[model samples]
Target chain A: MNRSSQHPLRELAERTRHAGAVLRTRSLETRARVLYEALWALADKKAPSGRHAREALARTTGLSPEMIDWSLAALPIEQARLLMFAERAEDRVPVDLAGVVLAGNVFVAAIEPITAALLLGAPIVVKASSRDDAMPRLFRAAIREQDPELAEALAVVTFPGGDEDKERALFSRAESVVGYGSDHALSELATRLAPGARFFAHGHGVGVAFVVPPDHDADVTTITDALAIDVCAYDQRGCMSPHVVFVEPTEHVSARDFAIQLARAMDRLGQRVPRGPLPPKVASQQLQWRAIGEAQGGLFEGDGFAVALSSGFRLSPGYRNVVVVECTRDRFASAIDSVSRFVRVLAQNGQWVTAPADCRCCAMGEMQRPRFGETRDGIPLHVAFLKET
Target chain B: MSEEHKRRASALIARLAPPHAIPREDAWRARDAHLEALRAFQKAQIPVYGRLSERFGALPVDVLRHARATVHEASEDIRVFLTSGTTQGARGAHPFRDLSLYDQAAKAAAAYALFPDGSLDLCVLAPSEEERPESSLSYMLARFGEWFGERVTIAFREGKLDLAALSGALERAQATGRPLALLGTSFAFVHAEDAFAERGVTFALPDKSRVMQTGGFKGRSREFTPPEMRSLISSRYDVPASFVVSEYGMTELSSQMYELTLRHALNGDRAPIDATRRFFVPDWVRVTAVDPERLQPVAPGEVGILRIEDGANVDSVAALQTADFARVVDGELELLGRDPDAVPRGCSLAIDEVLSAGDGAT
Candidate 1:
């Protein structure tokens, strides 16, 4: 096929695939160095690209400057971890060219998928969400700044969702497409793909926390303080953000009391790493959730935060809102059964009941900060882009 | 129901019905007093309302889902009006001991806003009361058909609109050369329109014909703006844009609000139908936009969640907080659809999504 006559998407895909073949010939250490350089460039607050990303993400994401900084803190994956992932990924065969459909929910969500595909030695053409194209674009720019050759292996594109021509163009060029979005969108994308095309759908999921009150200590301040961080992080936009926390109430700490304390902690966090401004729709949803909370049991709220002491587990609308329900150990399993399928991350203080098989269990404060090499939605990060063994 | 509560219910019902009887001047005062009395009665008669009121200082309309907010005993002869459980499995139920108040309020509002120009045949594309006993919308449509419609044809069956039957009814009405009143949920109308479009058919009904569209897409059909809906209905049904009226009612409340376009057009108002499309609350109900978190009334024009006080809700909790965002301009409610359920911009599942997933739609 004549290069000049090729569709733009096909030309882009061909160029990226040629670069991926070149990338495959390079040593793992060289590729790791390229990624490491790009990561640090963004991590360095004083760097021009880093500064630009923070400000641009703040403007595009509606997140506060402080919140954007907090999200950036999760980046710059350790050099050692990258090397380990690359080493383990040696046997895996990557698609010739991979198509990535990035979600706009959380800007940081773009990092893992993009990195995973690169680690698997696959060139990628990413269609960034219109609502949030800043991070992916900035990340691509960062990579180009570090290594122009490696940057050729990545191309960031943007088009409105539901544009069939653009989607068909992508399908024509890529053997595999990885999507991060709501289930409805994922299903639609799946239907658009050709027969036998590989698709990895990272659909939306919820995170929940389980609080086991200290056996003797009356002060649950430490627990609430940490939980508040999880709630405020990314404005609770990430799948790992806790929407509800089921507290096992003891004499020392009651669920209602914990809700009040959590609300206070959220207020304090709101002052430091304040929540981003809520769009009118989110604010309205928060109000409706608050009313439902008020109806269910008790509601304790402050500016930009609410802690509803719900009688049953109710998912918060995110944006630093949370529902705290009281449950004894006996009723724990049955209570969580309702939301088990949607639960992605289960942050807990003590082991009471085993989490759902597919759910990731973590400590109270580390809900949003899954460790390096952690499998996302039960798939090894890099393996998501590789051929199934 | 207790004697004291019954007495208060009767008083509120009598005052609210025949909506014209409420004095135009200081109508808010009467409505406020009635709401105040109604709240007091709810506090005394409804246990859930009393508990929620004591704890939270006010009862939200959502309480209707958790517990019945009615004065009548559970065993008593009561009719329960249910909300479509779209969000969660929680379907809100408003129990009524006397359908008489509902009947009177329904007829009075429809008479003034929907049928002010006189009766027309009703072509309803929704389930009847016998088919969907718990649906407030079905009950209201059924009542409207009986009270004002000279001929009624209900074409909804088994969760689907019988478009063929609806088309036949339209043809019959057109043949009669008598005016018609078509009533259906927005989704139902969209279904009919799509079905008609596929068959390359459209209706040119008789003069004075109108369409009453209520409810939202609920993810059932494609969504359209108010102007778009009016245009679609107008073009497809051969009615003027002003004849496309939108009704806004919820199961938790007794009173329904309607767009003033039809009533205004009948009254010789020359304004464009789009400009006059704001929903008008009856004199028997007070609609206030209140701060969602604080639950306090916001400034007149600022948007807030609507908190309605319906005197017609004499048997149930009267002060109902709806999850709809609206603003008041010139005493008319400019409804901005239901407060949208939180959509995860990120990859996190929203509450509504999770609930719907559990229902197997995922």
Candidate 2:
């Protein structure tokens, strides 16, 4: 059903409708490959000079062929084994989703669900942001121009900035809207979807790493390397990206020094990471908020104490790898209250656990246990829904 | 004291400051002698910095302290980069300062600027507790509020200025004659001015009611000269333009440049205008009108980029190149405009270009 003389998008829609004609018994692997091929075909093949779309994608997603080869070659079929590991989780729906929406994160990491959906043979409609993950957007184009059959199965388009109208439309046809963003915005967007659309959302999260004192017998290198991954990856943008760090301070590590060390790690990763735009409004707002810090008994200078901070890679006109506050370990959670009580794990004795020894109230806050390592805002993948299904 | 004595005092005080501080330069110390000292110290009392002892070499002082102040003084601290993605892009970096220096400078600047006499009812219309972080405005306001009182009276909603809170603050100030000054950015003042005026409510002026506005309308499209803004304030409130003070400072420098109208002063040009209203450097700040590009001081009255050396940022990066293009007229600093896209311009790129790239990045 590849659009020969007819419109390819329509053909893809029909093909998807036919492929997904069966409500149940769909394969996740089958669904993911079809979606990938479709995206590859739909990519913008002829952009202006030096306007190399692939290069741009590589620059943004940090997924040069080098990284992809590394990923495919080095890593096994080990897919981190999410909650619905080994097999797709089960859920019920009356109809095939008319469209699929993709949220941008680390491209490779963000595409897992798509692969699963292709396995299930679902057509995907991606709404990609220019923030991070440029590779997938480009690859979708490469796949489309290179192969039309795959292109027909996928629809990929990138908007410089997000448009709620387009999102609403995509969400409208979608039997279920899969999104990744903050909880607040996701629920709000869900309200705009067809009255009874399924919404898979990944709300904000703050990844946690423990500051275990390296044992004389322990491999300090292993500890540092593991901890550094939490620091260096995506400049720490994943929902699983570490925001507030809990260093179980000992004679070896001070929380204060650890904060600075984490900041330095981010600094070293600055060139290797993406420092995106901070809206002018955001900068102005920050300055104004900084002005009002007097109300909070805090200062915004690089004191690296109690205040929550943006990462080393930020959109501020002149961003920095700043650990703005030097909060005692006790106040770390409260410092990043904006992200809510999600995705934080205390690092004590070299183990990752959400339980805090001193936190009396629920040991958890007044909030629910949020998607602890969820990166980006609330957006869900159709395949993950299938996985759970 | 004579003018000579005042200048000498300011110079001496500035010199006494240990070349201000630069935190980036201190990063090199992990390979030097102070690494162990820094690690050892933070390992003990300084809880935030002791963790770097393992993978990286240590330093003499806590990294936070060094990052905020000591390293700011290093001229070549490469980490402090100007935003290359444009819009009033200058080689501006938020210089770091140790906890003490930041606090002291916050108190000094706020007190010296607003509460020069005594603590009064202070309210801010700018971003407050809910706003973005690591901003000098937040630091200054927070310090001012704590030293004086948490009297910041603006509420925020949907990440914007709460016009209602501003209105309520004005109404409260008017009902209560306690002298209150409105602190916020020039953009906020400009954006909200008409809204304030249309309500038929002039800013409620307390005894020595004043508008101490920070930030210039550098990137704003609707251009309004300083005098025009002064006029806006003058006509809006029944106060003379002289009562409206414009404070020009950046997060990069601890000192500020101020412009006060001498219109209402009884001792016009005859007696020396009080140093309080004059434009110059504070003891901790040194302002030089340089060729913006070469970093060479321009002749008096010649418009150039304002480069300042502040000892206050001892924990962060030191010297800063401001986005504002300015000139020194009679030892008083007068701003011209923002530097357009140019290399050797802070990040040496155009504002439009930077903004577009940022859009891409976002």
Candidate 3:
């Protein structure tokens, strides 16, 4: 019998599961402290590993170095927030082995669930996307450097997606799994999990912004600058990143004027944290999107970004390409009614139309920085980890 | 349309109404003259195009979504062709004051491409235009049956494929020993393939039998690449691989593009069958690869979004831009489909990706 060959995930899962038992014996304060220290090290710009993470992520993630730096600097790694979530994990029975399937789309997407798992003292086996494993690997390294004892509870492994045998090995042992990707992918992963194992899916959703007619006292520069930050964050890749900004024509500025101003703002921001290298296919798509925008209304383009003033609204395939639609409040609601289900975040400067039920509303610039307790895709972060009765 | 503009438009349509063996330069001359006339006619006759051209500098094909793009209002249209609203919830409609030009253009192109040898029995796996007025492909297939089909069998009714009826059509073609043309959307063909597999049935239709499939899977069935689809259709229908033709037409344009495999084979030019398939436009339609940013023609052999000028689109805008990415090689289009990386790398779902799922072209 060729017994020498074993799936790598099997042993890794077993090791983490065993470590989770010991990890659970520690007080919630210690586990939270260990997790916070590691995150803090990565978030610190002065730290070597922190700088290395930004550089490594720039290479691995198609984002530019400046954008990577901006993204890393924006990560919400506050220890107080970590402790707040940690207190919720107190007196709860930790999951035996928590399986995490990370996607390559947004590198920072791997953080929250992994934090929830560790904060609850659950040993985690992470199946890092082959396209991006730097964040998970670097995170594990940070944990190892901070506390080797807790490092035993973390394992980051990489294999091509749809490797069912390896996926089965991880799914069979874990009591819970959190998968991220398109909805189709998450569904397939759910089918392969162990019978009783619970599945938490962070599927793809869209983000939109609304700019109401500003008050007489409102500053246009402040609004456009903040909105530009929301658009440029993650190169407009995150679900929280706004794809379209619906601007109401005020006595002060028209929608076209707003689009032109936003174009300039994107240009100013691009100079600071330039848009990343776009794949050829994305570049082609961007062109088509711009042409469509031109046909629909007018287009204002700049270095690495474009602001399209469209008569109607559609989500732009984000790489800092944004659509600015002018409409009344009634028209705005009607336009978004059909796509309300996919709307993740509705960013606005002031009170506009009522948001959809599952959508999270935030100020224009703060779309990407959701507070710790807020629900993602309608699921609270605290509920992500296993909870004991 | 105004009487003067309609008269000029009709004259242009009449000049390029047939698919003939005209020289390349001569063909371009006639098409360009027609394109010029059609653009002027559209801007003059359609109020919407005038407004759009003034506002946007050029009328893009996407403006077809606006009701006023049509010469006549939707309510007064002699016929309106609706797009498959697969990409977005809103469907684009191309309204016409007259259907004669559209019919003539469709028949001429299909005859030159799919039915090079006059009319044959057509087993259409799609609803007739009378049944589904919104589907332009359905309208064109129904026209194919009326103009050329000696015997017609529509196996698709009310959005479902009648497998028994389709089997009967195949059996009839075998019994009569006459060539048959099978036409349907790609997803319908996939369903037929599945049905045949389940029934343990395959057909060896008469010689010269061919298949014409159009449209993408659009999440309707299991997706197969173009080569795989060609092989599946050829084997399932027991036809020569070259006889399996794919049609590329959209609701926005009156003209359609077709692969030249069947035509070349019919002309006794036997090219070795490979995965590569290039669609040839009719003499009346000229396609150019335009850089989306510059809105200008790209260098030869470079891939860009397709900008098609159809002389047959007499009532609407002559110049239209399609989202499809392609390369124009020696007047033939090598469709690379939509941008594969159009979906962002982040967790945010692009609505276009969600709406046009399984949009296989290449």
Q: Cα RMSD for candidate 3?
A: 4.1
* Candidates sorted by lDDT, best first: 1, 3, 2
Best by lDDT: 1
Give the alpha carbon lDDT tens digit for every residue of A113-190 in model 2. 444444344545555554654545554554445444544444555653245555555544556556655444455666
Candidate 2: residue B108 Cα off by (Å): 15
For candidate 2, give the lDDT: 0.44
lDDT (tens digit, per residue) of candidate 1 on B1-362: 34554454445445534444756546667667767777887788877778766534456665666666777787875788777877655777888777877777777778878998777788899988899999989999888877888888988988889877798789997898988899999888888888888999988998889999998875442778878888988999899988899999888877788987887888888877666368877766888887766667789988887878777777778777677888987677988877444444657777567665654211
Candidate 2 lDDT, B1-362, residue by residue in tens: 12232243233333323433544233223212232232233344322223322311222111221233232245644333222223422223344423455555555554544555556666676766445444566666666667865366754445567788877777777888776667777777776677877776676476576677776654445657667776787666555556677787765555555554432342254433333345544445555566532346789877655655444443432344443556666546666555322211111112243233332211
* Residue B283 accuracy (lDDT) in model 3: 70
Residue B254 displacement in candidate 3 (angstroms): 1.7
Superior candidate under DockQ, 1 versus 2: 1
- Residue pairs of candidate 3 with colliding backbone atoms: A105-B345
What are the Cα lDDT values of the candidates?
0.79, 0.44, 0.78
Fnat for the candidates in order: 0.56, 0.01, 0.48
lDDT per residue (tens digit) for residues B262-291 in model 3: 988998997875757899887778888877
- Which order, best to worst by DockQ? 1, 3, 2
Best by TM-score: 1
